[model samples]
Target chain A: MNTAQHGTWNRLFLAWLVAAVSTLGALFFSEVMRLPPCELCWWQRICMFPLMLLLPLGLFPLDPRVVRYTLPLALAGWGFALFHWLLVLGLVPASAQPCRRGIPCGEVGIQWLGFLNLPLMSLLAFSLIIALLASTRQKVSP
Target chain B: MKQKLLFALAAIVLLLGFFLASRLHTDARQEETRQHTALNQANLLRMHSPTLGPAEASVVIVEFFDPACETCRDFYPFVKELMAAHPGQIRLALRYSPFHEGAGQVVRLLEAARRQNRYWETLETLYASQQNWVQHHSVQLDQVWAALQGTGLDLERARRDMEDPAIAAIIQQDMADARALRVERTPEFFVNGQPMPSFGRQQLRALVQEALRTGGN
Candidate 1:
């Protein structure tokens, strides 16, 4: 394969890897860390989990347009995560918070580390996937 | 081609590393919050002298109650209902608060009843019949003791345990715990060491169910 072909594969593979790790990270938080997922986290996960299948499908057929198809869905997922993170950080009023099991999502822990909590991390992962997909699509078609 | 694969792997690893680092930081924050919570709860437990339930139970329900408080009397049925719904899942730790007139004597009598292993039955009976006895200020202490005759309890031991200093300390520690938790009224409930907000019975039941589902982990 030429350098361009190689680069295209690399970008797609990286995107898949990042998406998988993020999903697994979410699982670890929910199952092992015992932090229950709020409604927003669940929505993000639902959007991302499909990429586990989509990534491999895109890789085998060498159809970069596949990434385009998944990109919109993934972007929408990130939007939810970003909105949830903003609600958690109190950038917005709690009326925007998602309710799960009768408890508001904002009431749970806010930021994790200096920046990333569940929602922000999810948003970052989704963004990375989007960037990789876009880059790979450009390499394949152009 | 190999270099591209190497770059991809490196980028993926870096992303994972960043995520792990952030999670570690969150874990540290959670640990600090947990420690602060535990210490606060311990202090409250020490002050209130609340009765300790079986240490083996997965969930602990600590309650602050005044024998003569109408609210406390009203909450008794709810408590009984909860216990009935989730048998052995929860252990009830009752702390007597003498904030109301005649509550101290009633608490003593209830503690004394524990010597016969009839503490719960006696407490339930008293709560169910609170209006009948709580207002009789001139009633003799022995008459209260006599009321337990048909419950198949040891009347003598029940009377004796009422004044036990050890029991008094337990009750006091519970009161302190309630104070620390900022519980100002009777019938305040704490599920697994967390202060429950004022909510309806359905909401409270849902909270407990969620706590159970989470295994209190």
Candidate 2:
């Protein structure tokens, strides 16, 4: 209703944006690009897909408690994406990787900027969501 | 400044924990593999594995395919084309990969048909009618059975044979081989034990050609 409340709501919208973009990007990669998802990709999807629905439900009324729900999902997704990124870079050995067949664990189905691949992009998006969520927080005592 | 530093440090530790946990978990898996007893030959290819083309052909194509996979249905004709082109020079092996709901039941149907010496016909019929039954991630079994009427299958026999423990064992073996080979998707093809270099119609043709040249015999 007031200016400060409106500002808080808009800032919180970043969580919604991250969820929408990442979910659509995943669907586009699978449905449009015809790239099959590997096992880790599927795990990452399981984490990311829920936030798209959950974050938007918190909007309209624009509750700050949305962060409490969305941040846990974003963190879990970031963990999967981090492991996936390391696997892609061969930081994890073939013997130690979950994706040994089908599409392989280290495949870069898409890349841009000479550095951004799928997992990095996922990690970046999740990091932004977490940061945006944190920024909207009104100081907690311990 | 101190709060930001602490937040950054905590984030780093959380990430490190994930990475290390994955590494340790896979390390344990690798150790398990080293200790795994020799895999049974039956797991790799049962005596009853489905086949197309010649049984003793020089080139063997092992495709791990789920009955409910749309991609498998799409790839079916291409596989047939390759076999037709090569005549008796190539053999196509079908390994069950019932990764979808109701896919195991379809596998049982196919196995039962194999018992009646009607495996190829049943496979073609099921694929041709995949759209009618595979609805919203579930199989319409009654529709599938309806489509099978007057197809020369002894319907009563098929129903009885579907419950056979042999069929269960065959499906169980295929799933194990799929896990051992790390097959995560349907329509995965291996030509003479060599995985297709990449997934494409052209890549499949190319791999089959390479196999034919080197070991086609």
Candidate 3:
């Protein structure tokens, strides 16, 4: 209701923006670019896609409790993104491969700016959303 | 009132994004197909690439494949089945893409098997035991050799032949042709010198069927 509340709402909006962009980007890659998601990417999408819907609902009311719902999704997505990053980096062993068919998870499909790939991009987006939600949790708590 | 406005705005943006994406996809596909249409037919085949089915078959399926790619391995049987269904009417020519980390070695091994006239058997052996040899998206060369045991190939000769410069040249030539065709992924197929309208099993089968109906030998 106050200026401080408005600021917290802005952070929530920022989190929503990140989720929206990530969700749309994932769609663009799969639907438009025709790059099929591997199993790990699917798991991560399961986590990220919901945040795009959930976060915006919290924004209109400026609910600090929004962090309660969105943070979990962001965290789980972050975990999957981390696992995928490690898988592509060859740190995850072959025995753990979830993609037994279709596109292999370890195949680096898109490389932007020389080194940044899709898994890394997903990792960064989830990380940013988590950080934003964590900060909003502290500032908006009465 | 503000909440309704915000939700409506979000919906609009999402819908616009999806619409834009679909348009982009259509335009890109048209451009890609046009480019593929202009590609020289000679770029799609090589004398040295592994071929199956009757030599005089009117329908030729050229596949850009990676030995270490799982989809390529999985689709191998389906492609073989397609050729079988058509019998002598459909011929298959495999071009090595070898985009994976250790795939180059496996391709080299397969080429060596060709020297001993065991290319098909060696490829089958590798596909049957692909999981054992392909580790962390890279080919385990030793495991690949172990998997090839049932193929009755002379391993020593194959190994020595793997180092042959001519084999390397074959790989290089296939790769150059793959580039010419703009093949960025494994298991990409061209039926009768035509690229798939889109990439999938059904699309490949449909293309082959069309070819068979119109141009069967």
Q: DockQ scores for all the models shown? A: 0.05, 0.04, 0.33
Candidate No. with top DockQ: 3
True contacts kept of each: 0.00, 0.00, 0.42
What TM-score does the A-chain of candidate 2 achieve? 0.89
Across residues B97-117, which tens digit of lDDT does each residue of candidate 1 receive? Answer: 667655777787777777666
Candidate 2 at residue B211, lDDT?
Answer: 83
Q: List the residue pairs that clash in candidate 3.
A: none
Candidate 3 regions with alpha-carbon error over 4 angstroms:
A1-22, A29-31, A34-51, A59-64, A67-142, B1-9
Alpha carbon deviation, residue A15, candidate 1 (Å) = 1.0
> On residues B123-211, what C-alpha lDDT tens digit does candidate 3 reach at each position?
88888898998888887888987887756899989889999999899999999988888888889998888888777999999999999
TM-scores for every predicted model: 0.45, 0.55, 0.69
List model 2 lDDT by residue over A96-121, tens digit each.
77873568868888889988999999
Per-residue lDDT for B43 in model 3?
Answer: 86
lDDT of 1 by residue, A22-70 (tens): 7767776776455777787778888998886687676664556677778
Tens-digit lDDT string for candidate 3 (A92-124): 997898896668999999998987999999999
Best by TM-score: 3
